[model samples]
Target: MNRKKEILEKLAFIKSHKELVSFGVKEQEVSHNPCLSEAEIAAFERKHSITLPDDYRFFISEIGNGGFGPGHGLLPLNKAIVDFKLRDKPNISLNKEFPYQDDWNEEWIASFDWDEEYPDTEIVDAYISTAHIAGCLQISHFGHGCTFLLVVNGNEKGHIWFDGRADYSGLIPKMKDGHRISFIEWYVTFLDMEIENINKSLTNSTTD
Candidate 1:
């Protein structure tokens, strides 16, 4: 029962069932920008040398502070409830539209395939908005965890994932002059906090 309380009880069951499945995060209005200052995240981990754990620097300084929005701009992919039972697991694919290059773009690692993969998929959460301002980030690093997330909004750019799994004609793998980026309709209205300290520590669990 460690691993940071199992990733905070799977983000409190994704923030409590996230309104029975949508995109979770209904009313979260707290602003005052200019965040990311722990000496600017330790100088962005000493100029990208690495070592930014502690649960991804407390999940980007506390569960995505000053950002995570969909008030109007874009970048929102809330589809949980186990994503409709892994929607026809030919690997699975739903949210479409992608291309926005830039962000460790070695051709987006050819959408992952570095020699037959499968270590819990890959990408673990990403969001990039174009115009105005809107940002969300996640990437739980796996099989060589270094992680990635690039948020920009003026020229528009968005990528969202939290563990990869795109195959069934999801058509992932683009970078021939990348600049696609789309999916920004709107969702994620989850709000159901306080779970009695995670159901009283999972009902006094004894390795069920």
Candidate 2:
């Protein structure tokens, strides 16, 4: 199928399935400050303006909380690191399941290159699986809207979905075409916090 047509179908499916997952956002918490506003997001009428897919928004908000880690228990964002490392290893089977399974075959993996081009620095990481050829995962923060933009690689721009809030500043990197890069910095941030909490718990257990 063509890129435009595929995106349209995905959008239609997502719009219809908004209720599949609970967004966890209290209707009363819609406050606005710097990054993004409900009004601004609502004003975005074109799909090219953002980097999120209609259905993928669930992964950031309702599916995995704001940041993609272990919120849903379905697919962990940490898995991306493993996938990237094993991209050229062997026996890689790209399955179309949640988190998208992979075995690391050179032929299948080498077909895709990570650093072939200077991607947007703002985008901390990007991912692609056999599930969707045109779609790609992007991590980036927009002003106060520290969200995820799961784009369609190089086709139509993409859509923007919330990934919670963080206090950050300065210019974030975007694609050469002027699109923002996905930010995967939170994955590491969350990993550190998880380790700290675990260590603290272990210490407390020993003392107790």
Candidate 3:
């Protein structure tokens, strides 16, 4: 389904209403970056050895490369890759199957529960190298040590996940109504909420 028409309409409304405090709008500070062409997107996919999820692929090619969405704003597609390498090991690559179906930090912690008096620094070092982020592309920094990732391969492809491991919350899927939220769903929710906030702000001002 084509969302370009609908998404642009919301973006236009948000951009035109400068007086409103739309979510992430001030952080973006301007309209989003220019849209990338289909060829540009294809080239990126080729280089990365992974096909982006349909909605996200469409967004970069049709809406904008990146800028303004959830949290501190979406990042440019080129900057979205996770470093999946652990030490001298090669990257696991984005096309590899995403390793988890649910929260994974607990598993990670269990893997290296060293003695408090004699911590295994090498094991801890490996954990910090981002092995858990394999097969995903980062989309947003959710602030306060949290990140948002888009699963790039395997069964979870196309769904957004919350990388909350920094806060010891684990890698959790973004869910709504018991289902994982897709890229489009996540984005449209942001647009809807921002529009609602703008309308409320305008209404409150008029009544005053």
Candidate 1 Cα errors over 4 Å, as ranges: 1-25, 30-34, 50-66, 70-178, 181-208
lDDT of 3 by residue, 6-75 (tens): 9988888887875686644665754678888988888877887888899998888878877878878887
Which ranking of candidates, highest TM-score first? Answer: 3, 2, 1
For model 1, the local distance difference test gives 0.32
Write one digit per residue (lDDT tens) for candidate 1, span 1-208. Answer: 5644554455457455343323223443222233355776776445433334344355345444334333211211121101222323121121222233333222345576758963343332221111101232322121222212222122323333222222221222122234343222111211122234445455656456
lDDT rank order: 3, 2, 1
Whole-structure CA lDDT of model 2: 0.32
Instruction: Point out the worst 10-residue segment of candidate 2 by lDDT.
Output: 25-34
Q: How many backbone clashes are present in model 1?
A: 21
Write down the TM-score for model 1. Answer: 0.23
Q: Quick one: best TM-score, which candidate?
A: 3
At residue 107, what lDDT does model 2 achieve? 40
Query: What TM-score, computed on C-alpha atoms, does each candidate reach?
Result: 0.23, 0.24, 0.83
Worst 10 residues of 3 by lDDT: 83-92
Error of 1 at 100 (Å): 12
Question: What lDDT score is found at residue 159 in candidate 2?
Answer: 33
